[model samples]
Target chain A: MDKMVYNFSAGPAMLPVEVMQQAQAEFRDFNGLGVSVMELSHRGADYMAVAAQAEQDLRDLLQVPDNYKVLFLQGGGRGQFAAVALNLMGKNAKADYIVTGQWSQSAVAEAEKVGQVRVLDGFETTGNGPRALADRWDLDPTAAYVHYCPNETVEGIEYHFVPDTGEVPLIADMSSTILSRPIDVSKFGLIYAGAQKNIGPSGLAVVIVREDLLQQACPHTPAIMDYAAMAKADSMLNTPPTYAWYLAGLVFKWLKREGGLEAMGERNKAKAELLYNYVDASDFYSNNVHPQARSWMNIPFQLKDDALNDAFLKEAKAEGLLALKGHRIVGGMRASLYNAMPIEGVQALVAFMDRFAKQHG
Target chain B: MDKMVYNFSAGPAMLPVEVMQQAQAEFRDFNGLGVSVMELSHRGADYMAVAAQAEQDLRDLLQVPDNYKVLFLQGGGRGQFAAVALNLMGKNAKADYIVTGQWSQSAVAEAEKVGQVRVLDGFETTGNGPRALADRWDLDPTAAYVHYCPNETVEGIEYHFVPDTGEVPLIADMSSTILSRPIDVSKFGLIYAGAQKNIGPSGLAVVIVREDLLQQACPHTPAIMDYAAMAKADSMLNTPPTYAWYLAGLVFKWLKREGGLEAMGERNKAKAELLYNYVDASDFYSNNVHPQARSWMNIPFQLKDDALNDAFLKEAKAEGLLALKGHRIVGGMRASLYNAMPIEGVQALVAFMDRFAKQHG
Candidate 1:
């Protein structure tokens, strides 16, 4: 096996080395079946077994309630922005959105095309930086749902507390933060996470929707986005991204072996602290987001001298710390420590940062 | 390397052994990037290079006209059924559909949910198996488009001739037949194929659409399915199935090295002939599809005594022939001789059929 690199891509981030090795071993033949898992018929017994286990394993890892149907769907996070509105925006024409950063803003845009959208308490740039979630907002009891992105990949901010949304169902686009830590699933009516981030691969989203929330999709909703239809078909309404789902299963099993979300949260917290503490102590480096709002999964920091950004990334790559460059929209360095990224990787990144700061300063 | 077994699954079917081997080798590190292609950023130069080459190679293989845009999309063929309607159904509210088998019927059903659909000379189920294409049909000159599935996967039928719908744009669901042969891009307004078959994996579809036909998507069309938007973004409007796209690029390169589509069509034709000749000559076996309409990719055959179906499948599996059992909806046996299936595999199947017939006949 090749020497592993510490990959910090925001999405399509690192998967556990064990998961990758297992996938490599099974790429040619899966479970004594002569065909690759990708070659098996989606309706065939073998593929269905893999699919069922993936959903079951995810349920076990998240401790997902029995009342919520877990759907392995295609079309990514952007697709779900429209899908969320189409499926849940019942007779009520308006949906409330809390815009903290780029992703939540995008969610509002897609929802606007499908139905009326109300951006409630949009993000205000504070002295430190733009906070991910507003301090407080007027609740709209009649709105279809309250939508927010728990973690913004670009903004590098996360909501540490669950918002108090009275009777309206809470819908979260947890694309970047899902599975990085444990959350109360019962509090939110629907939670969607793109698989590319912390889950498994690209091109699929795992939507966990409360059973009662399945009613009242828009008349023009695409069948692929119809929550009720998808649940009824058990996410086999169409050919799924079988390889991604299978790989996610491997990651789920790996998570269970590593002691599930509870253990993951502790390790992730330690990883975040190691980097944040190092940055906070150094006058040469600074993170823009407020400490309370900083995301544990994605930690974006900037060098005091902006001109050194390119040189910093190049040197980091040479050190086998890959993809530390922040999103193009937000210039600087962002290290995404997903569930698969080990604490050792974060320690290496902190060491690199310390060396780079001393050399440049 | 494990000894290869012949896989006869219809879709999510066989990929070239070379492709699988290369993917396995790169599962850990791609191009010495120290991260799997699945872990690379979609917008990164390395991944974009791979994505661009995939589109270029596919264009070269098919000789796709410059006027047509090749889009790498998510949500499979079932999604395209509605996307085709949502995007192309302009001022004219109706589209003509030729229902040949289970797939085409599905196309009509999904299209009906989005827009007006008129079944054009649908199959009457004559004494032979459901004929894929209607022998004669009235062309709806004023309709938005003429939709058909050139290959019906479940019924194991294919249309050897492109339909003559003068002036009106023609849309084909070539999910199972794409890349198996050369095609005239000028004849069709849009051509879509789910990647699970000849392309790469499930949950991704490649849509080749003429530049002029991109206008007038329905107001409710999901942004992911909007051709003009996807075309502008080069299919990176959202996160694509990056690993699948990379694997598909590898497949395209392999196809090019094997002398492109002309060579592939010849190999596929010869493989089909070998199996069809054996089935036609044997008294114990029978194929229902007409000679002209038989698919070069998938061949469905029945045993003289239906009771022997299970036994035949078991013996075939033990003999290293895997997934030969026919679709449950259309029972007996289906031997899908896709592009990856070697001529030797077909010969082995023929030999196995002979032995099974002798033992049971």
Candidate 2:
């Protein structure tokens, strides 16, 4: 066994080993610049190269249209929740939010502060069980935009269908779901993802917004959160999350080398299937979420015998698996299989689970 | 000369070599935890240690009073401009701003979005000249707070005296000035600094706000931007910039080991004086700012002959002194001497300036 364990955190989850190694080597000096990437100015040639390439790579990966402005922002997923509302809400504006999970609820609530918010109640959460189909969404016609999250980290629910809001724009918080599956950027007016999971680190938030949406910020919008100002400044309205941008750029390159999103989606799907299949086959363990709504990124399952919860976690840690304990909001074990987690890691996890289950059962 | 060049960019400045080395060593694996700090969940025990220690060290360095809360936030320094107004402008309906330079102007513009803005204009063009002092400032009593930046990074202007606002809380954006000198925490109601310059990376913004100022956030503040939410969540309202926070902790240790703020202040003073004295003595180079208001952190100077600017920059690069090229807004060379820049780097810059001046003259 390796000296260190495999960590399965939800958001700030595992990073690519090769990427981490490269980052480690470049921590003191970057491209003969004689200083760490973090130590370079945001506007300098060195960091500008880092920023430019990152945006290009992301655009290429997502096939982001020319009509969209790619923005690198801060304040994580939560910060973007506020930014989206402040930037999109205009005079006499209202937004329609599809309440799929925690993030969507937060977004709708935050938007209500700046403008009117109408929850669509799109996906139903039955004791964190199977989620409703996206076609069942009840969107408001008066909305400036319809907001939803493609994937919910804690509830492990993902939308299989996209809502057609007609002329109204679609905004998605793809913090957990980005890069894990193929996405149609043209379908959404705006899409923002925190960089902690599939991209790189926690500091940078990436926003892909259609050009038309950029001009409608509420008069009271903060300049940093103003989409138009950010697009005008090339996302350097202030000193950006430089190091995070650099790292995400590297992750983008890695994604390109690994055959882009289609390939990533297949691999992620396979990994999730492997883990979920194992859990389903065993009478000792069961996944609570409906299979159709199940997320490929986060696999949340609970042991049939509740008494083994502590023992399961303790033994899992002892066996070199770490952070498998589910989120406090949902009690059980959650194995978040992000892009970085190879198929082999899932196999290993399944093997460990099988052995532990056979003994505990 | 040392193998590495001195970085003099205003922001995303040099970090301590020890901290860099430590980061490099621990980049792939943090404290034998097997995953990089960037890969850990912000709420995890290990990362919480990083957050706690970073805040504690900052408190120790500032000798912050118990009533103040030091928050680690995102959106760079510019983001804080909006967050401050969003959180602090509730008590009264307006905020008073003392405009010193471009950054202060940005702050005033942002605060105008949330509440009424009272602009204190004299300092922008002439207050920090040879005849000015901080005591002569006219402040508003009904204003929520009087905001100012102690140092104008681009203008190379520094405040020698803290403005006394009496019952009106004094809020200063110390993004470019913090950790360069000793500050009495009790003097200001709130102090905020961007981490890129004197602290760590660009993603994290450190805010030191008095306790009494925490509660009056506008009813609908986002969890991440709400000062009370941040204080309660310990700046992990969402996942923080983990690695940046960790690096800051190392910088704090380095500061304490290097004999604390007094020792750092002495070195900074000496470094600034060395450059200023050279500029004053030499006819080839001149700094337009009044001597009393010249900044210790950023020293902006211009060559008498603008034609030599290109040659000066090229020669400076060849001599291993970098980022001497000034901002486009302020057309001249700017040498940012942060805490990490050793005394020898300043000496080398002065010596290079002398050689260049002698040749040009």
Candidate 3:
């Protein structure tokens, strides 16, 4: 057997080993169709069944309510940044944005092209560090919707609590943190996650939106980006990313077999704690994100001797731990432990970190 | 070895067996990397090399001029419909379309959503049959571009000659016919094809656009859809459909091994002639498409007795000649002889057709 390395790259991150194996087995033939799933026609019965079951499994896993529609869309998170503005900022033409980190700031930039955006809160920093979420946020009650990124992968910050937005719809870009834990599905108006992170591959995006919000899409919204049109066509407005969708379905099945999101949350929390606790205790390494707001999926840390960053990454890679290097914007190390990453992978990473720190110190 | 079946899907169509096997071999690991290519960071040197090489191979295979940019975009053909309008239509605010069938009609509809669309010609049939391309067309010299589908997958009609569009840029949706033949790159302003048909998978669309036309994209174009932005970013303005792009690179290499587009065109012409000639000579079978305009990639035919349609499809599936049923809009049968479909597959199909007709007739 080939040596398996633990990959910690942030989006397009790790997928379950079982999912990969099953995918390889079915790479040539899917369910005796005599053709790879990638070659199956999008409109045919076989592929349609795969698409439908994927949506149903996702719905079941999330316990999504009846009034919401789960759409398997294309264009990734970036496309949806523009799409969300076009679809939801209709006649109102105004939306409130809460800027937390790199992703939310990027969201604000894209949304600004389409409408009047009110930055309810900017990334303010206190004397200690980045300002807490509790800082006063000037939200506009009449805004079309409230938008924010639930988890910022680059800054390694996540919202541990859902903001209370009573009547105005709440939209969250859950790209990095989706499926890492179970949350109340009814709390948000819409949740969009690019599949590459927690879901499956690059090209597919999963959007869950309340049905009533569908009709508000602007007239100029591209057919593929319009929520109403996509919902009506069952996200078959065009040929979807069939192979990615199939892989995502396999992942959903794997999630179910591992006892769904609640069980997954427990496993994920334990894994995050194992690494974070180790870093917190070590004088040589540290993470700046407030402990309460630190993400369970992505953990970014800095070594005391900044020069050792390259050497540490090189050593970790040599030990069969890969892609642990942090984002260029936030230099050091970032270990993204998505749904597919096991407790053992985290354990291996922690052991490697301890050895690297001692040798360098 | 597993039973290899002939897949006749019009899009998300057959890929070469060697490509599939190579992909499977690298599914667990790529170039000795512990992670799958899908799991690799798009910004990393390893993946960037993959992206750059894929573009180079595509350019080499197509002889795409330096003045033209090849963008590996997401959102399929449908997204490009809206994008083409948003990007190409400037102050003129108008474009001409030659609607041959479903795809062109759809394109015209999408373009109409963004600006003024003039139907230069429609799919009109006289007592003899569908009107020829040489027939009178109301040309709009001042229009931004003249858009047409070089090959209509549903109608099984293809352009035997490029239209004479003087100064107006000519855009062709070559979704079902790309890479099946050689063509003059300088003849058109843009050629966009959804990768599923003759390229790779469904989610990716390859757009080869002239550099001069890049500057004309409207200010309101979504950054992801903007040709200029994508060109500047090397199609990495955002995380691309990496897996699909990688698969497409493998395809470009395979095309080179099979003697590039010139050799592909020759083989394609012979394969098309073999099936069309057989159909024309058979008293029990007929193809409505004009012989001169019939597509080399997709050949749609009908039985004299329509009652045998179900039986034909059922028996074909049993023979491992799958997805032989024609599109619902244009019913009967369609055998898509994409580059991946060997002459042997066509021979098997032809032999089966002869047997089916003999038994029923």
Tell me, by DockQ, which candidate is best: 1
Name model 1 segments beyond 4 Å from true: A1-4, A125-135, B1-3, B122-135
Query: True contacts preserved, each candidate?
Result: 0.81, 0.79, 0.66
Where does candidate 2 clash, by residue pair?
none
**Share of native C-alpha contacts between chains A and B (below 8 angstroms) recovered by candidate 2:** 0.79
Per-residue alpha-carbon lDDT of model 1 for B1-361, expressed as tens digits? Answer: 2565888888898899999989988888888887899999998889999999999999999999999999999999988998999999897679999888899998888788777899975444345433344445777789999999888888888888888889999999999989999999899999999998899988789999999999889877888889999999999998999988988899999999989999999999999999999999989999988776788988999999999998998999888898888888889999998888889999899999999999999
lDDT score at residue A187, model 1, on the 0-100 scale? 96
- Total clashes for model 2: 0
Better of 2 and 3 by lDDT: 3
Per-residue CA lDDT of candidate 1, range A219-326, in tens? 778888999999999998888899999999999999999998899999998998888899899999998777777889888889998899999999998889988888
Write candidate 2's Cα lDDT for A1-361 as tens digits.
Answer: 2664677889788888778778888777788878788888888888888889988999999999999999998888888898899888666678888887777887877788888887777555444333444556666766788898988888888876676888889999999888887899999999999988888888889999999888778787778778899899998888888888898998999999999999999999999999988888889888877666788998889888778989988888787787888888888889999999988788878988999888988
Report the first chain's TM-score for all candidates: 0.97, 0.96, 0.97
Candidate 3 chain A: worst-modelled 10 consecutive residues by lDDT: A122-131
- Which residue pairs overlap in candidate 1's backbone? none
What candidate 3 gets wrong by more than 4 Å, as runs, is: A122-135, B122-135
lDDT of each: 0.88, 0.85, 0.89
